[model samples]
Target: MNITFQKNAVTLLGTPLKEGEKMPDFTVCDNSLQEVKGGDLSGVRIFAVVPSLDTGVCDLEIKRFNEKASQYPDVKLYAVSLDLPFAQARWCGANGVNAVTTLSDYRERDFGRVTGTLIQELSLLTRAIFLVDDDNVVRYVEYVPEITDHPDYDTLEQKLNQVIRAQ
Candidate 1:
């Protein structure tokens, strides 16, 4: 998908993953520099992809998800960025973003490339949201057309509620 980065048209590295697609095998570094394999994660997951935590919009997106995630205690919320692991840890600690686990794609951009969130021009992940179920199938996806815009939080909530209702 093509996203406007500060109004400049830039396309993603690959076709974005759509709902119903299985999670691709990928690895990302946690805040502690631990390797996390995407396939190993089992349960409802909400992945919030951002460019960097230092940016105002990325900061707010993760913070808002971290704050609201408490209501859905069973769901795993993750914030992925291209920043280094130490920086992610520092940002999470400073912002008190405990509810969301931060992951870094600095080394290989494994997760970003597999998920098609990597921006071709900037080599950064664009703003997006992916909701994956226990079986590892993507149930909801929101690839924000613009990097500066926020994803539809209410629609995401409704999708989560739908998952709850299904159970």
Candidate 2:
């Protein structure tokens, strides 16, 4: 899909995963540099894809989600980024962001490619949000048209509530 990056044209490779589609499994590294595959994650997952954690908007977005994640213990809020595992750990520790688990896709960009969030020019994942059920089926997806903007958290919260209630 073609998503705008600060209103500039950018090409996102692969087909975007949508609602009701089973999320494809992929492996990514966590803070400890341990491989974490999609199957390794249990319960409902709320994936927040960001290009990088060093930027202002991405940092704020991650912090916001980290705070809101405490409300839903059953849901795993994954902050996906292209940052290295060491950098991710440092950022989490420095920012006191413990609620959301930070994942590193720097090695392979598997998550980016699978979700169709990879920016071809920048080689980074675009800002997006995905809600996958316990069954691994996607329940909601939000591809932010602009890379620097925040996601629609209100809609995300509503969808999360509905998905949780249905389960």
Candidate 3:
């Protein structure tokens, strides 16, 4: 059987996201199953945090960022993952991840296709981070080449600081 997958206009998986690109509006489900859309973050600096909560690296990434989220009071952090809402809620509950808002894109294919994070032959999202300003412009993006590796937190922190300072 031949299968064709949808491709994004931009390939972000192995490349750094350019600054000034407007982020595509997307709707994802929150832990409570309520729809969370990009419009809800119009005036907030958003961190599009992607991970696979079931994996060790992803768990550590979420935990680390959740801890750092407290320091960035002006920034809104959203932990985006492919895990089901129930699993995400359970994981956050057990890990005490109250600082960052966890969102799941499992129900929709927008995130995976629009962001180019969906693995070609797998049901997993690539480890990546996207920093969007209040105007919804993508300021910084990092796509870890190796799915098993963690993102560079220091670099992300620095960029986030820049965004905060600019605001």
RMSD of each: 0.9, 0.9, 5.5
By lDDT, highest first, what's the ranking? 2, 1, 3
Instruction: Give candidate 1 regions above 4 Å deviation.
Output: none
Q: Against the unseen true structure, what C-alpha lDDT does each candidate score?
A: 0.90, 0.91, 0.73
TM-score of 2: 0.97
Error of 2 at 40 (Å): 1.8
Give the worst 10-residue stretch by lDDT in candidate 1. Answer: 10-19
Alpha-carbon error at 50 in model 3, in Å?
3.5
Model 1, span 1-167: residue lDDT tens = 56798899987885689999997878999878889999888899999999999999999999999899879999999999999999999998999889999989998988888999999889999999999988888999999998999999999999998986776
The 10 consecutive residues of candidate 2 with the worst lDDT sum are: 1-10
Better of 1 and 3 by TM-score: 1
Ranking by TM-score: 1, 2, 3
Question: What is the C-alpha lDDT profile of model 3 across 49-92, one tens digit per residue?
Answer: 55568778878888887888778877777888788899999999
Identify the runs in model 2 with alpha carbons over 4 angstroms from their true place: none
Candidate 1 accuracy as lDDT:
0.90
